[model samples]
Target: MLERLDDIDWERLGHAYGTAEDVPEQLRALRSPDAAIREKARWQLYGNIFHQGTRYEATAYAVPFLLELLADPATAEREELVGLLAAIAVGYDEQWLPDGLPIAEHRQQAAGGAELLAAAPHPGDDDFDEDEGDAEYLASLSEDDQDRLYTHVVVAAYDAVRAGVPLLRTLLASEHDLELRVMAGYALSWFPEEAEGSLPVLAGAVTEALEVGATAADGPDHTVLAATALVAIGLLGGAPDPALLDDRRPLVRWGAAIGLARAHGPRADPAVAAELLGWAGGESPSDDRVPFLDGDLAGFAGQALAQLGAGRTVETFDALLRRIPAVSGVEALHVVGEALKLAFPGGALTGDVPFDALDERQRRLVRQLADHEQVWRIDGSYFGNFRLLIGEYGLPDKYVTLRSYAGQG
Candidate 1:
C-alpha cells in the first residue's frame, strides 16, 4: 500500500484544500502507536479529504489506502479505519442524518450520475452556465478527466469499495471489537445483496444490546450501536421486529419505526409509523433522542416525516405538520418548501394545477409552512439548509430542497 501511495500525484489532488500534498502524512498517522494521534489523523483526513461529508477530488485517491489499513490485522484502530472507509465510500452526516444515502440508492445514483458535476464555475469563467448540458465541459477540460464531475469521481471510487464487499462482510461476521462489528454490520448494509450476512450480525448486536440494557454496563453504548445496526438492517431491506417498539430503549423504538418505514416504503407498517408519529412529536419523555439527528428530536422527526411523506401516505404528512414548533434553525424554510413541493410533486412545480386542487389536509400543510417563511426570510434563519444545498450539489443537496411549489418559487 505504501509503495502504491508513493506513485500517486498527491499534489494534483484537491480536498477542502487546494492540494492534498499532506495526505500521505495523515495516512501514516493512522499507524501511530499513540491512540490520540491516530484519532487526530483520522479527523484531519476527514476535514481535508471529505470535508463536511462532501467528497472532494482527493477522496477517491485515499480510498484504497483507507481500505488497506482496514485489511491489516495489526492495525489497532480497526474500528476507525472501517468507519473511515464507509465515510469515504459514501459519506456520514454527523449533524442531521444518521448517515448518507442508503447503499443501494447511493450506488444506483452514483452509478447513474455520469455527467453530474459538484460545481462548474471555475476560478475564471466569463459566463458560467448552470444547466446540466452547458456546464459539463467546465470539468471535462481538466487533465485525464474521464470523470469531469466531482460526484462521478466519488462514484468511481465507490465502485472500488463495491468490489471489496467480501472484505467488509468478513469484518462484520468475525470482528470481536463491538464498534468494528457494529460498523461493519452497517457497512455491509450498504450493499443490499449482503443482507444474508448483515442481518444476522445486526440482529446479534440487537440481542447483545438488549441484554446489556438490563444491566447498563455490558458494553460501551450498546443501545446506540444496536439501534444503528437496526437502522442499517432496515436500510438493507429488513424490517426491525415490530416488538422493538415495546423495548425500554427509546432509540431502539425510534430506529424500529423509522427503519421499518425506510425498508418497506409505501407498504410501511402503519403500526410502526404510528409509533414514529408519536415519537416524532416526542411528547413521551422516554423518547429522549431522534433516531439519527443531533438536535431536537421532534425537529428531525419532522424532516424524516416529510421525506417519508414524499413517497408514502399522507399519514406521514400528518406527522410533519403536527409539530412545526419542534422544527427550528436553518432547516425550517427548506423543509417547509420540501413538504409543499413533495405534497404535489409535479402539479405544484409546473403550475399546471393549483394548490387548491389538493385535498384540504395536504393543502393546509402547505399553507401552514409557507406562512412561516415570512418570518424566516426576514431573520435570515431560514435557508440555512438552502444555501448548503446550492453550495453542495445544486440540483439535489437533500437538505433545503426548495423545489418550486404551488405557484410559488
Candidate 2:
C-alpha cells in the first residue's frame, strides 16, 4: 500500500486538500508504528500536502498532528523538532496551542539564536550597551535550544525599544534563516523610529516573497511583516515610498495606508488623503463596491483615515456615515466612528448644526433616523456629538426634515 501510495498521483491530492473526509488515511500513516514511515507520512501530510490546501483545512488537519509531534518525547533532535513545531504553530491560529506547550520554550529558542549573532563583533557595538544579565540568560540555554530561543526572542524583542533597534539591525545584515529574517522585519513594527534605516531591506523581503509565489499563507507573512515595518517607519514621521501603496496585495496596500497616516502632518499631501478615501469608499460606487475591510486591514484603514484629520469633506463625511449604518456589529461601528472622529468629527452629524441647537422638528427627524437598531447604541458617545445624534435618530424617513436643518447649520 505504501509503495502504491508513492506511485499515486500526488497532484490529485492537492485538489482534495480541504475536505476532512480524505484525511483519515493520512492521519493513520502519520501515527504508523515504523518511525521512518511515520515521519515520512507526517512530512507528506504537512509539508507537501497540507501546504497545498486552503488555510482552514490545512490548519484543521495539520494542527493536531503537529501538537502530537511536539508532545511525543521520542521525537529526536528536540531543537529541530521544536523549530519545525514552531513553524507549524505559525501556520495555525495562535489560539489553538494547548495550555502547557511552553510559549517560553519557543521564545527561548528564538532568543538564543539572536544572542549568538549579537555576540559576534560588529562595527556598531559601541552604540549598543551590552547587558550582562541578558548575556547570561542566553548562555544558559543549549546551543540548539539557543538558536530556537534566539529566533523567538528576536521576534519578541522587535516589539521593544532599546532591544529591537540593534537586534533588527543585526538580523538584516546576517545571512540566517529566511523565515527568521522575515520575522525580524515583523518585529520592527515596535520601533518605528528606527524604521528609516530598515524600510528598504524590509521592502526587498516583500518583493522576494511576491516573486517566490505562494508556498503557504505563511509565505505572505514576510510581505505582511515588511509592509507593517514600513508603516511603522511612516508613523515615526518618515516619508515612505508611495509605490509601497500600489502593491498587488490588499495587505500591502493597507500597510502603506497606515504608514502614510502616521507620516501625514500639518501639511500632508492631498493626493495621499484622496487615495486613502478611495480605498475606504471602495473602488466603485455600486452596492457591491465594499472593499475588503476585515482583520488588520479594516482597523488600519479606519485608524489611518482618522489620522488624516479635518481634511475630509462633507460628501466624504456623509459617505462614511452611511457606511457606519450599513456595517454590521458594534466593532465595525466602533472603527467607523473612530475614523470619522479622527478625520471629520463635525461633519459626521446629520445636519451641519450641533445636536443641542436643532429645533423641535429637526430633533424629531434626528430621532426618527436613529431608529434602526443597528445604528442606535448608547456607546456611540465615543464619536462625540455627531455620532451621538445618529445613534439617537432611528428612522430613515425623517432624515429629510433633519437634513434641512443640518444643511442650514
Candidate 3:
C-alpha cells in the first residue's frame, strides 16, 4: 500500500518541526505490530505534520498514506487515523461548528491567491530571496501575501482530505466497526462540498443505528453513530428525516432536534428550540467523547440556541445561566458568550452606563455570570477566544475588571 512512500521527496517537504524526512518512517511505524510503537508514531505524526491545528506543507502529502492505512482492514486504531485526517482537513471543528465548513468561500479565498502563486519567483530567479527557507520568505512578504500563501497551503491540505471523502463515506457505511464508522461520520461533516455523496450514506447510518437500538451486547452507547450522522447531515446543510424525531431513544431525539435546529436555523420548528433548551440545562451526555462540542451537549445546545435567533429569549438566557456554573473553562466560556449575546445583541452595553442602565434581566444575567468565579478565574491558551468574544461586547474579560464592570467591586 505504501510502495511510493520512499518515492516522495519527503526531505524537501516541511512539517511543524522541520524536514519531513522522518514522516516516512513514522508512516511505516503505523503498521507496526507493537501497539506502543504505533501510538508513538501517531503522536509524532500529529506533533509534526498537523501540529495544534496548523497544517504544514507535509500535511497534504501525508493524506493519501493515512487514507491508505484507513482502507486497510488490518490497520489498528483506524478511528484515530480517520480523526487525524479530519484534523488535517479542518484544524479545530469548534471554529466551524453550528455553521459548518465554509467550503465554497474557503476555496474562493484560496483560489484568490493564484496571482501570488504565479508571481512567485522560482528557486533560480534573482528575486527568489527565500534563502533561509519558506518561513523567511513568508516573513519578507506583506501580511496580505503571507495570508494568501498560508491559506493556499491550508486549502491544499483540506482539498487533499476532501479527495478521500468517498472513502470516508464507504467506511461510514460499513457495519463492521461502529466506532470507526462514527469517526468517519464526524470527519465527513467537515467536507461540506461532498455532501451530495456523503449525505445518503450518513442518512443510512442513522437508520442503521436506530434499527440496532443504538446498543451493543457489551452496553456501549451505539447511539452516538446515529447522532454523529444526524449532526453531519445538518452540518452539510441537510436535515435528518423528521420521522426520526419521534424515535424512541432520547439520544436519537436529541440528535434529530439538534440537527433540525442547525439545518433550518431560525426557521426550525419552535419545538426544537424547546428540546435544545432542555438539553442545554440538563445533564450533558455521559459519553464525554461524543464527537461534537467536545461532547458537551449542553455547550452545543447553547450555541445552537444562539444560532436559531432564540439567543434573545428569556428561556435561553435562563437555561445558559443554569448551565454556566456546572461547566468551567471553555465550556462555561461558550455558554456565557451565548448568554451575553442573547442578553445584548450587536454589542450592547458597550458605552459608559451605570448598573441601572441595563434592563433588569440584563443586569441579573451579568451579575450571575460575573459572580461565577469558576468561569472568570480560568487562564491559558483557550482563554483568548473567550476574551475576544467578550471584548466585542465591550465587556472586560479579566475577572477583576469584570467584577468592577458588574459593580461588584
lDDT (Cα, tens digit) per residue for candidate 2, span 1-409: 2233333333222112323334445655654677786666556555543363222212333434444443344543322333333333333321211111234444545645545544533222443323332345446666776566435433432222223345444554352345445445543433444556666666565555555534554432445444544554564455566776667766566556666666764355665566556555542222111111223344334445656655554434444444454443443443444533434333434544465575553443344334333444445433333444344443122334444434531
Question: What TM-score should be assigned to candidate 2?
Answer: 0.41
Clash totals, every prediction: 0, 30, 0
lDDT of each: 0.60, 0.44, 0.79
Better of 2 and 3 by TM-score: 3
TM-score of each candidate structure, all chains considered together: 0.67, 0.41, 0.89
* Model 2 score (lDDT): 0.44
Residue 118: error of model 2 in Å? 32
Q: Candidate 1 at residue 149, lDDT?
A: 53
Query: lDDT ranking from best to worst?
Result: 3, 1, 2
Best by lDDT: 3
Worst 10 residues of 1 by lDDT: 393-402
Q: Estimate the TM-score for candidate 1.
A: 0.67
Local error of candidate 2 at 353, Å? Answer: 12
Off by over 4 Å in 2: 1-161, 168-186, 213-223, 266-269, 282-294, 313-316, 326-330, 339-372, 375-409
What local lDDT does model 3 show for residue 138?
Answer: 62
Query: Distance from true position, residue 148, model 2, in Å?
Result: 37
lDDT of 1 by residue, 1-409 (tens): 4668888888655667656789999998888899998999999997988788777767777878888888888888787776677767666443324223554544454443454444444322444442332335645555434333555766766666666677776775666676676667656656666668667777777787677777876446666666777777776767788888788777777677666766665566666657667755444332222223333444444444543544544665565565544444543443444455445554333323455566676567645544444323425444455445323322222222323443344
